[model samples]
Target chain A: MAREKRRWVAYGLTVPSYLWLAVTVFLPLIVMLYFSFLSKMPFGTAEPVLTLKHYKSFLDRDFYHFLTWRSVKLGFHVTFFCLIIGFPAAYILARKVHGRWREAILLLIVLPFWSNTLIRIFAWTMVLRTNGLVDQMVHAIIPGAPSVGILYSYPAIVIGLVHSFIPYMILTCYISLQAIEDSMIEAGRVLGASSLSIFWRIILPLSLPGVVVGVVLIFVPVVGAFMEPRILGGRQSIMLGTVIEDQFTEVFNWPLGAALSFILLAIVMAIFAACYPLLRNRMKLT
Target chain B: MTRWIAYGRRIVGMMAGLAMLGATSVAVADEVRVLNWKGWGTDEAWAVAEFEKQTGTKVVHDYITSFPETFTKLRTNPGYYDIVVLNAAFVEKAAREGLIQAVDPAMVANSADLYPDMRDTPQLNFDGKVWGIAWVWGGTSVTYDTEVFKTPPTSLDVLWDPAHADRVCWRDNAEDSVRFAALALGQNPDQPEDLDAIREKLRALKPQVKAFWKSGDEWLKLVAAKECDLSIVWTNNTEAAAVQDNLPVSFIVAKQGAVAFRDGLAMPTNPPNAKGAYAFMNYLISKEFYAGWVKIGGAPVSANSKAVEELPDSSLTRQVLTQPDAIKRLNFKGPLSDEERQTYLDLWQETKAYFAE
Candidate 1:
């Protein structure tokens, strides 16, 4: 009787969470799948026409293939740049800095979060555009220099995305780094290990879980990123995400958008499946 | 265990009370809510306040970010909205979907004063009933920096000119991109005689394009930075930039004419406050309201001819529109069917891919 009561309690506690997930996540995904098979948008009393043409068109088009590659490449580039920049900052904050100063500096790191993301993107335009902030600063430093107009390019997209997503890498890595015992590093030093060797052999391996999590969080959204690419990349901004968005927003073809979204989801799942083993082991530490 | 049961019951009671509060507010009959682009027509605070003064009903608004979103909001949340602002192209689709109902002419006397061409379009008339009430309209055309070109290019051919090609900005929308390219190729925008010509023309022009802008904010940013020499822009945005922003730009309707679009007001199906909605819609399209809207600045040309006529000669809307010249040159955007739009969008995506290549 007691065991049954405990089981009922468990179900009562978990039921709300499961219900929330069904409503927010699974239900919408199922609806999208249904919409993907529709031949056209059914209106008024008209019967819905279902077909497999939306999927067929994806298979047939070289445009979708090229855009998919571009979006994935973009994800890789942003993830890589964030790691190279954020890992060091997080390491210093965790190891080198201490107490009040560390807290203040950590607060400084999160300062940009106060402003909205769209505003931050627009702000970057003012800095990167011709004869704008960057140009003004450079021209002040060196007289008669040509402007470094980097706005509306592939590099600008990378820069904007990295700035937007780097905080994830920093905060996640900081959590892992803070958990590492000082005694472990002391033992490594006592065993006559150099700083670089200690880092490669122990510190990086210890922080692997946080780094992987951060990579996933940043990479997934960056792959589906449309606004940053369109704002910063301009004419060169076309990607799988932009194409999918255009289908719904511009072309008014919900079926094509749904099909493209499912294809993207499948590709992301395949990538995660390949990495699952390594991720499982590393994630256990946290 | 007994204490926890009491706690659970109290939480449930609180939630039920909150739900009841939401229901009561929504059930208010005197409130007429409209959905439209922010600060456009019906949402104009002054106009809405004036309506509220005469009619006891409260006028409220919710803003839509895109055309598809307007449909989603109305269909998903029935009785939430009473009116929606639709572009000329969307009236038929809205009516066909039963998302909106036909507005009787008796409901709006001001609608009679709307330009005959706008009131009598096939897009508005179907099954002997008008789907949308004509509101305001303007053209999509080229705006050039006076600083860059001493002599303003008089024709659409200026877009393809090699000397000025490196600084041209095009809108990123597929339908508009296809339509403009068709116009540049001397083909009908609605049903282009040659689809292949549009594809080739877009590919050839891709090299010259400095950037593509999606929003007015981005277009203005590009202009301020001198990143573009010529850009495809809406007439209202051009007037604002030249007059308000003090940008040295010239708005010109090319010899081929501008791509004209009209904004209209439509009634959503089974509104919570249909009587209040009609009164609000009637007040929005009146000549007095339009005259006030023009004074407010950033107003599009009025659909009612008399409303436009009332504006002073110094009004920027009057000077830029030049009704005598503009009326003749206005090239209405085709009410292209869904299948045709899909085809145009497909070709446009292909052209963009080619641009990337």
Candidate 2:
């Protein structure tokens, strides 16, 4: 009886998280899957009749494929940009900076994230707007150069997403870089290796794990990002997120929305699966 | 043990007495809780005072910020409100879903007091039965910074000009934005069922737009920053932002015209205070009340055309989204079958993709 009661208590303890996931994640996925195979009702309601009309609709259009490719491209650009800038910053902070200054600098790098996400995006908008700070500075510097405001462009959208997610990449790399013993680099240096060779041979190989984690964390969401592109990007920068959102909210085609979401999910899963074997090899080789 | 049992029986009797008292209060129909659009609810304190003076019923008001939230809340908790304000697009859906109750004209005597045009507007009646009462109507148009442009462009064609490319803003809302672009492209999205050509035109104009604003706060911020010189915006949001923030913005009736909209008041399927709701609706439609509301930027249904004339021109009216005459040239957002609407939305997504490319 005591064992049974303890079991019940353990189950009860996990109920909240399970319920939350069921409501927000699992249930929605199930509903979306069911709808993806259905026909659209005349009043924008999902019909009870089962059909693959929405799936076929998505397949028939070349636009979805184009959007998916664009999103993947944007995601790669963000991941690559973050890796280039973030890895070096993390190395300097983790290896070079000492004692209190290191902690303070790291804190400074992450301090801006405490503010609300939406407010941060709005701040970016202000900085990028015409006659705003960036444009004003440009005019002052060039005198007669046409003002190039960053607002409503793909560059602006990418910048906002990068600025918001860069800290994740930095922190991940910092931990990985910190985990490597100082002796490993020193040993490489003592073996007639130059400073650059020591880093390339030892530090670069060790940091792959953090790089994988950071890449997945940023890449998955960036591909699905809607608000950043919608608010900052002009007509020339629609992402997959916008397409999925239209299926649910304005179009009332929940089924199509669900299908689009699954398509994205499938793509994300496929990438992760394909990367696993390669990542394992890197882990073992390093 | 006998004494303890006697005490328990007395406690049960007392609990039953309290339950009876609670039931009596419910039967009295004392308080009416209302759920509605942000600005359209009865002046809660004022309505409470007036209802108390006349019918001895109290009023409770709950305001929802957005239309989707309101619909979701109503469908989820139907009994939470005695009445709600829904737009034409939603009224049919709400009625068909049986989320709202049919309003009996006899209960709401002031139903006759509403202007005939408003009385018969598709917003209030879904298939001949009264579903809601038309309260306000307005149109969408381009709001621009007059100070920047010497002569603020009157035509939607200005939006397509290469010179103005990347200088224009549009509503982020898909339904309105799609129609606005279609009309700007010289296609009557409201009238024609054939939207393929309209879709292509909107897709072509995508490169010219700078940003899609999602909120009034963002619109104000965009204009203040000079990030955008021109925007396709609603009259209420533009007027409120301009008047409140003292922004250098003015709205105009785009030459191609834009979609007009209306929102109305309706009762839910089962109301807690049905009689009191009827009493409040009656008081809301009085000419004195209606005129006072419109003067303060509330677009009351002008049942008596003289009521509109009675409204003093605020400096803002000179720059409303569209004049009544301009409204005539535009397409009315009447009934759209589900398939027809989805096609438009699909085209909107397609057009968005074209611009994105």
Which candidate has the highest TM-score of all?
A: 1
TM-score, candidate 2, is: 0.83
Model 2 clashing-pair count: 7
Per-residue lDDT for A120-235 in model 1, tens only? 99889888887879989999999899978788788989999999999999999999998999999999999999999889778988998789889999999999998888888866
What tens digits encode model 2's per-residue C-alpha lDDT throughout A1-286? 9999999999999999899988788764664576576564222132245677777776899888899888888888888899999999999999999999999989988987898878888788878867778888999998887877777788888898899899989999999999999888888878889988877778888988888889999999998988788777766557888888766666566668878878888898898899899878877866
User: What C-alpha lDDT does candidate 1 achieve relative to the native structure?
Assistant: 0.81
Per-residue CA lDDT of model 2 for B215-320, tens digit only, reads 6677777777676778887666666666666777777776678677766778888887787788777766556555555555524334434345555566455335
Number of the top-ranking candidate, with lDDT as the measure: 1
**Alpha-carbon deviation at B292 in model 1, angstroms:** 1.4
Show where candidate 2 strays beyond 4 Å: A1-28, A40-47, B1-74, B89-93, B105-113, B126-128, B148-154, B181-188, B254-256, B279-310, B318-324
Deviation in angstroms for A273 in model 2? Answer: 2.8
lDDT of 1 by residue, B158-250 (tens): 888898766888888777788788878788887889989888988888767888887787788888878888998887887778767889887
